[model samples]
Each structure stands twice: as structure tokens, then as C-alpha cells.
Target chain A: MNLFLDALAWIVAPERFEGSSSLFVRLGEHLYFTAFSVLIATVIAVPIGYLIGHTGRGRELAVGLSGAARALPSFGLILLLVLVMGVTNKPAAAFTAFVVLAIPSILAGAYAGFEAIERRTINAARAVGMTEWQILWRVEVPLGLPLLIGGIRSAALQVVATATLAAYIGLGGLGYYIFRGLPLGRYDEMLGASILVAVLAIVIDAALALCQRLFVPRGVAAGRTPSLRTAPARRRAMVETSTAP
Target chain B: MNWVLDNLDLIGRLSLEHLRLSITPILAGLLIAIPLGWLAHRYRLARGALLTSAGLLYTIPSLALFVIIPPILGISYLSELNVTIALTLFVIAIMARSVADALDSVDGNVRQSAVAVGYGALRRFFTVDLPLAGPVILSGLRVAAASTVSLVTVGILIGVESLGYLFTNGYQRRIVEEIFSGVVMVMLVALLIDLALVALGRLAMPWARRPGRAAR
Candidate 1:
């Protein structure tokens, strides 16, 4: 309880909030790493997800790749990458590691979002004189947005959490406090920083969950959209397996 | 390769520690999650609350949880117990939802028939509901297993010993082969656990291989 109290005080200490290595600066660096990695992952993954979903090809490759990635220890991956790539350009190696961490969930989210759409609806869209491009945009993308966001939701959460670990490689983030504090027995700084990271994760997750709910097509009223909140147990469970990283 | 060969005994010992650390929480979490999942499923009033709390738990990173546990539990921050407790929480978060969902997936009529045959709630749960829920639970188990094994490696940062020691030790020494070997060994352990779970599922649920009872 005393340690917890000290941690809470540490969070409120004005001295801790400013300066080059202040709480706010580390927080900023943390979110910056998270957003940067997720952005790159999104660009690379969403298109591949689209190709897999739209054409129903190479899905085994996607699934197999993602599964393999999930089993990898992120800590090991970072250290290995840093050593292999030469630590001189640490950001490239670290962010590449972060991108790898983000890709599987986003890719699964993108493709699974498309797969969640009703087959009959797609047939109807085609019958109404929609071309391939038109059907994909008009029917698939809007409906699949919810799961895509869910994927991004989990991916962003993963990156946010791992960005803390990225600090292990000497990048600046909130993790700097915890990693730096531990060796020196600075419990307040370590505990205080972890609480901040947890809060950041929860707030981002709630925001994304809201985004998922809001962007669920208004037409999906009677039947639930395929996002975890409203999707049936089975579908959400499938999403859970992919999103765990 | 030379470092790895020289450290064979160290690797074997850490691998055992890694497996022990990983498996404890998975087994313990399953035991806790089933009851929690049952509570969520059995009581409509609590379903939303139970599941939402479980969802919230996952958002807290394992590393954060690792640090937070010692303070709360009065254990040393570096103790193996803290790792198990924190990991068990995560597995519960992942599995409880899946367990509730797994129970929900059990056909309503099938459960009704079990009740009709005069089986008590406990009896039916064991013979019918649980068995029926087994495959889904096993899948959730597999996911939890793989991730748990991987997550256990993070404890090295806090000075808890496991295969994760290789990561820190290798990085400090700049031993590329050593780091590579650590990564491979963790994945290998996870893969072996996954296969074992699959085999156990097959042995326990023969009907699962047939039509209408397919494996996931």
C-alpha cells in the first residue's frame, strides 16, 4: 500500500511532469512509437488483407504467417533484429519489429471483416448491377469496417503495450522509467510509469471500441455487425484468437 | 552456434523453467475461468459485467501487471509467484470469454435433453455441457498456451530466470546465435504444447472428428 501510494504521488509530482525525461515526454514518445508502427502496418496489411478476402486466395499463407508471428517472443525478436541489423540505426530495427508485431492482427482484422459479410447480401449487390470494384466498395468495405477497426483496435493496443518493451532497446518512451528505475530500485518511478501505460491502453481501447460500435453500419440493426460487441460467440472467439498479440 | 553448443545445459534448464512457468498459469487459469465463465453464462444479469471486466483486464500489459502484482501481493517484485498470478489473470481474461462463448455454443436442445434424462446439474455439466464445450475451450486453451509461453519470456527483464535469460544475456554479449536460439526455443515449446493439446482433444473427444462436430 505504501508503494502504491508513492506511485500515485509520483504521478502527481510537478517535478516529474516536466524536463527532458519527464512523464509527459515519455508518454508522447510512447504514443508516437505506437501510432507510427500501426500506421505502417495498416498500409502494408490492409491491401494484402483485401486481396486475400476479395479473391479468396493465399488465405492459408496469411493464417499460417500470422500464427507463426503470434508464437514468437517479441523480446527475442527485438534483440535479434537489433543485433542482426547493427544497433547503429536502432529506430529502423525497433520500428520494424513493432510493425511485425502489428501486422498479424491488422491483416486478420482486414480479411476477417470481409469474410464476416453475408453471402446473400453480396449476391444481391451483384444482381443489382454492381461491378467487382463497385461491389467491394459499396458492400464489403462498409460492412467490414467494424472488424477492421477491431483488428486495428487490438493491433494498436498491442503496439502501445510493446512500445514500452521497445524502450528495452534504448528508445525513449514511458518504459524508460520502468526499465531505468528497476536497475536502481526506484519503485515509485517504475510503478507510476506502468500505471500510466495501463491507463493509456484502456483509454485507447475504449475509444476504439466506441469507434467500432459507431461505424457498424446502421443497416445492421436486426442482425449484429461482426465486431466483438455484437457478433455471436463463435465469430468473436475467432477474432479473439487473432487479436491476442 | 559455438555459444549455443557450449550453453546446452543452461538452455535445457531454462527451457524447463520456461515450460513450468508457462504451464502453471494456463492450467490454473482454466480452472478459474470455467467457473467464472459458468457464472457469466448462467446469470443473464451478470453476463455484460463479467465479460466487460475480463475484457478490461487484457488491456493491462503483462509487464505492467508483473510490476503491479508484487506491490499488491507483498511478494518480491522478482518472485516467480508474481509471474504466475499475473499470467493467470491474463489467461482468465482470454479464456473466460471463450468459455462463456463455448457454453453458449452448446445446443440449447441438447442441454434440454440432458435435463430431461434426469441428470443433475453437476452431472450434466460434466458429461454433457462440459464435453460439448470441450472443443471450443480447447481452442481457447491453445491460444492461451502459445501466448503464455511467449509472455513468460518478459520476466527476464525483471530478473526472473527462464529461457528469457538468454535474450538479455545474448544481447549484452552481442551473441546473434544465442538470441536466435532463444527465439526458436520459445516458439518450439509453444508449437509442441499446441500439438499436445490437439492430441489430447482428439483422445478425449472422438466425436469431434466426425460431421457436425468438426474441429476448429
Candidate 2:
């Protein structure tokens, strides 16, 4: 339609790419906020998640709390923080909000990753005289990876979406055009920016989906767990009966 | 505190409006998605196409959709209908996939039995498959309900009248109590709706209420 065409024109207008507040800058800002917050959230949430998952402790509580946390309206949290912390420091308030938003998904993913590993594998590792730390790194971490990445993917998506809304705090991001253009009635800019952001999200999701596929080891991809038996035992078992992934 | 007290009338009105905006889409989405889900579940070829598009549709942020929807619908950009319509699309996107999965979750043996007993296709679906799929669909519905309730607040940014109005209005005027009330009220509404859904699921599917199952 004419509106979508005009929006496309707005995106390609040469001047829109040159200034400090240009399209590239806004796009960078959006990715910057998304990456920063997701990283921080992973650092904070992953350890606790791993701890909970490995120790077999507090998973029910973690799941419940994370589910409950989703209802804590981020828009209100951002505004409340800005008011309490000082409007002069919008990024700090906004950063805190984004981190909180990113935590629940990453936490769920982290714990679910370790939890997904079968107990038989852990028991085998223990019987083989593996130390606690050794078992964690060699056994649990490797197996827990696919689900961990899955959590991060969803976390990244959530942050990307929320960062657009964070533009209301006067931060620069793809959402700037949508929010800032609203009052000015700049429908073309709004539509153009929204379309760009939507495309960015889809591309990122597809890339992560690829990562999800590629990151899994060939055996796991083939739907078989790696056996812990010694090579000779594995060969003996293979000789006795065919066990194919 | 007095500010909240003085505006209790306003708060009550906004809460009602918020419930209508949020709940309308959820119910409307569930109704529309049942058939779409049935199609996707019944036909293998349609499954990939339906699920893929729904996943992509869900990835677009709610705020962005608020802006993008009006132009496509040829409605006023600030119209509440835009918010409701966009919310409905998101709900449908989420619920459709869940519905398909829910239908797929029904026991194959039970379905075979229904056919063997001479129940017509439509009657079997309505009586047996749908009821058996109820718990899974209800679980998905709970998730959608919570998110939808929270999502309604974002519509405030685009000039939709909901509890989200309290957020913007309170923030601009720097009234912490007003904003705080909005947050609390939104959560309360979400909790009540979720509890109601759980009760409905329990009442409708008494067979699902085993003490040992911890699906939650």
C-alpha cells in the first residue's frame, strides 16, 4: 500500500542514515541494549540456575517465581525505577528493568538444561569415580547446553521486544521512531521503524534456531545419548548387538 | 494514599475497561483458534505452514504491532479497536499452536474408540477429542491469559483506554501511588483471571484432578 511504500522511502532517505540519531545509530542502540541486558541476566541467573539444577533444590520454587515474575509489568517497573532513582539517570533505571525482564527465561532454561540430563548418566559418572566438579563440567554442562541456548534465545527475544518499549524513557533504539513519531504524527517513520525491528527479530530468531540445530553434537542430533562404556566394552556390545544412533 | 483513594472511581472504571480489552481478545482468540487448530492437527501438510506463521506472528513485539496494525486495518491509529484487534492477533497466534498441540495430545486409543463406536467425525471431535485435550489447552490458555493481561497495559502507549492509562498518566504527573496502584491492580486482575481459569478447568475436567499429577 501507499503507506508501506512511503515507509520504505522514509527508511532509505539518505539523510536518515547520516546523523548521530540516524537509522544505524538507533539500530545499534537497540542491539546494544538487548545484548547488554541479556548478558547481565545470564551471568546473574545462570549460576543460580545451574546451582539449583545440579543440587536438585528449589526448582519448583524457581519455576513458580519465574512464572509469577512475568506478570510484573515492565512498563510500570521502568517508570517506577526512573522516578525513584532520578529521571536524570534513565539508562540505569531502564537497564535494571531489562535485566529483570531477561532473568526468568534464562533461569528457566539454565535449570531445565541440567534437569534434562538423565540420572543414569550421573550415576554412571559417579560410579566411574568422577569428582563433583568433573562430573559437572564433563557430564552435566555438555548435556545441558541445547536447553541453555534455547533459554538464551527466548531471553534475547524478550529483551529485544522490551528494549523497543524502553525508548519511552528517552533512550535511543528502534522503538524511538515509533514512540517519538507518535506525537508528531510521523506514521511513515513509525511504520518503517516497526517493520525494520520486526525483520531484525525474525532474522535473529532464525539465526538462533540455526545455532540450536548446529550446536548439538551429532549423536544428540541423531537422538542417542553417548554411552559411558569404555571403548572395549562398547566394541564388545557392538559385536554382541548393533546399537546405532 | 489519598490520591489513590480520591481516584478510586477512576481506578474502578479503568480496571473494568482493562478487563474487557484483555479478556475479549483471549476468548475471541480461543474461539477462532479451535477450528484453525483442528485443521492444523487433522492435516499434516497444514501443520508446518500454520505453526511457522504463528511463531513468526508472535515474534513481533506488542508495541510495534500496535503501530503497524492501524494502517493495515484502515482504522484510526489511536482507536481502541486497533489495540483489541492486535491483541486478538497475538492471542490467536499463541493459542492456535497450543490448540493444535492440545488436540495432538489427545489419546489415540480414545479417538479410535470413538470412531469404532460409530460417533460421527464432528460429534467425536466435540465430545471426545476436545474434552480429552482440555487440560493441555487450559494450561496454554493460562499462559496466554497472564501475558495478555500484562500486554494490555502497553496499549496505553498508543492511547488505548486501559489500566495502562494510569501508568502513563501517573508517570507524567510523577504520582508514584498512582503508578504503583496500576501495577498492583493489573497483577490482581491477572491472578483472579488465572485462578478462575484453573477453577473452570477443574470443574469441567474433573477426571484431570488427580492428586499425584504435578504438571504445573
Candidate 3:
């Protein structure tokens, strides 16, 4: 259809490559918010999840809380924060909201990674005279690296998808075009922006899938290549199923 | 608190609207996903392609999906149908994979025995595999339901009516109470729906209620 071609042409047009709202700038802003939010989430979530997994306490609580947190509407959260912050500090409000959205997936990943480690393996490490800290870092961390990365992948994907909301509050991202164009009846610009967001998401997901494959312990990665991409999906399923309490 | 009390009727109406906007998609998704999931599960060649496509569809941002859906379907942007169809797409993307995964979780030996007992394919699916896959399916439905409830709020950005309108309206008007109420009401609705689904699952699956199974 003409619409599809127009959108494609709009994307490849030279003007789209320059200026403040250029494709490159918006992509960078999208990545910056995503990376920053995921980093903050990892810093907070990983340690809490690691501790919970190590101690073998409060996992039900953590998983339940994470599930509950996931159910909190991101749009509502962002707008509420904006209102609370007086809209003068839009970036800070948006950053905090995105961080909140990113945390649950990362935390679920961290705890699930530790949960996936074998009890017998940890016991063997202990028998070999490894201290608690040594066991955590030496035995658990390396083995859990793949799932940790999977969690980060999930968090990154979520942040990337949701970060378009940044544009709702006047922040920069690919979402800017879609939101702006919809009101102005510029369907080509809207579709072009959407295509870019989708492409960015798929590229990042595939790249993370590759990272998961590369970083998994050799023994674990040996025969499980096909199922590597499902690591986060399985962990997410576990989180959903384990929330009875 | 006083403001919340004063606007209770408006909040109640929007909450109902939110429920309608979100819950319809889950029902629609379930209707479609059951057959697609079973087909994916039944065939070797279709599994990879089916699951992969579902996964890929899920990666499209919610906002982008909302924006493009009207144009793609040739519908008016302001129609509530846009949100319904988009959310239905999301639910199907999530539920189809989970449905297939749940079917996969059913014990192979159990399925084999049912076939050996002379049960027909369609009969075996309903009487044997489906009941066995119930718990996992319910959990997947729970995830989809919670997600749908949260996503319904995004409909507001496209100027659709829902509890999210409270957030947008309150923010624009600087009415802190309305925004807080919107946030609180959405969470409560999600929690209630989740609990209702769990209760329904338990009621429907009597075998899951057995305390002696934990003896293992």
C-alpha cells in the first residue's frame, strides 16, 4: 500500500538523520534511558535477590511483591510521579518510573538464577572449605551468569518497550514521532517511528540471546543451545506460578 | 480522602469501563489461543514458527501498537475497538506460548496411556490433556490477566476512556487526589481479578486441592 511505502520512505529520508529529533538522536535517548534504568534496577534488584536466594528466606515474599509490582500500571505510575514532582523535573520523574518497571524482571532474574543453582553443587563447594562469600561469588555467580544476563535482557526489553512513554511526558525517544504524528494525522511518521522501535527491540533481544549463549557455563551451554532463549520466559513463568502466598 | 469520596461515582464508572476494556481481551485471546496452542503442540513443524512469531509480536512497544493499530485495521483512532483488538493481540502473544508450554508440561506417559486406552484424539484432549494442563494454563492466564489490567491504562494516552483517564485528567488539572485514586483503584482491581482467577482455578481443578500430594 502507499501508506507502507510512504512510511518506509519517511524512515530512509535524509532529514530523519539530522536535527534534535533525528532518528539517531532519538535512538540514543531511548538507549540511554533503557540502559540507565536497567543499571539502576540491576544494582538494586540483583543484590536483594542474591541475598534472598543465598539465605533461602523470603523468596515467596520477594516473588509475590515483584508480581504485584509488575501489575502496577506504568502509565499511571509515570503520570502520578509527574504530578507529584510538579512536571518541572520531567526526566527525573520518568527515570524513577522506568526504574520501577525495570526492577521486577531483574529481581526475578537474580533470584531465579540463584534458585537454579544446584544444592549439591553448593554443598560440594562448602565441603571443599569455601567460605560463604567465596561460595556465593565463586560457585553461584559464574554458574548463574546466563540467567542473570537473561534477566537483564528481559529488563532491557521491557524498558525499551516502555520508554516510549518518556515521550508522553515531553522527553525524547522514538515514541515522540508516534505520539506527535497521531495528533497531526501524519501516519507515515508514526509508522516509521514504530518500525524503528520494533527493529531496535528485536536487535537487542537477539543480541542478548547471543550473550546468554556465549556467557553460560560451558557444561550447561553444551547441549542446551536451543532452549537458551527461553531462559527468561521460563523464569518468568516460575515467578508467576510461585505467587500463591 | 474527601475528594475520593466526592468522586466515587465517576471512579466507579471508569473502573467498570477499565474492566470491560481489559477483561474482554483475555477472553478473546483464550478463545483463539486454545486452538493455535494445541496446533503448535500437536505438530513438530509448526512449533518453532508459531512460538517465534508470538515472541516477536510481543516485543513491539505497547504505545507503538496502539498508534499503528487503527491505521492498520482501517478503524477510527478514537474507537474503543482499537484498544480491544490491540490488547487482544498482546494476550494472544503471551497466552499462546504459555498454552503450548503448559501442554508440553503434561506428562508424556500420561498422554500415551490415554491414547492406548482407545480414547479418540478430540476426546483425549478435553478429558485427559486439558485437565492435566489446567494448573499451568491457569497460571499463564493469571499473568496475562494482570498484564492486561495494567496495559488497559495505556488506552488513556490514545484518548480512550478508562481509569487511566483519571490519571491524565488529574495530572492536567493538578488534582493529586484523582491521580492517587486512579493508581490505587487500578492496583485493587488487578489484585481482585488475580484472586478471583486463582479461586476459579482451584474450584475447577479439584485434584489440585489435595493436601496429600505434598507428602511426596
TM-score head-to-head 1 vs 2, winner:
1
Candidates 1 and 2 compared by lDDT, better number? 1
Alpha-carbon TM-score of each model against the true structure: 0.94, 0.92, 0.92
DockQ scores for all predicted structures: 0.47, 0.34, 0.46
Give model 1's TM-score versus the native structure: 0.94
- lDDT string for model 1 (A1-245, tens) is 99999999999999887789988788889889989999999999999998898888998899888877878898888889999999997888889989999999999999999998888999999999999999889899999999999999999988887888888888988888899888999999899989988989999999999999999888884355355476344422123232211
lDDT of 2 by residue, A139-174 (tens): 888788888889989888888888888888788899
Q: Lowest summed-lDDT stretch of 10 residues in model 1 chain B?
A: B207-216
Across A56-131, the per-residue lDDT of candidate 3 in tens digits comes to 8998788788779868988888888988987889899998988988888888788888889889999999999999
Cα displacement (angstroms), candidate 2, residue A59, comes to 1.6
lDDT of each: 0.88, 0.86, 0.84
lDDT of 1 at A28: 88
For model 2 the local lDDT of residue B126 reads 95
- Per-residue CA lDDT of model 2 for B15-123, tens digit only, reads 9998888889989988988999988887767888988998898899888888788888899878888888888888889988999988877766667777778989899
lDDT value for model 3: 0.84
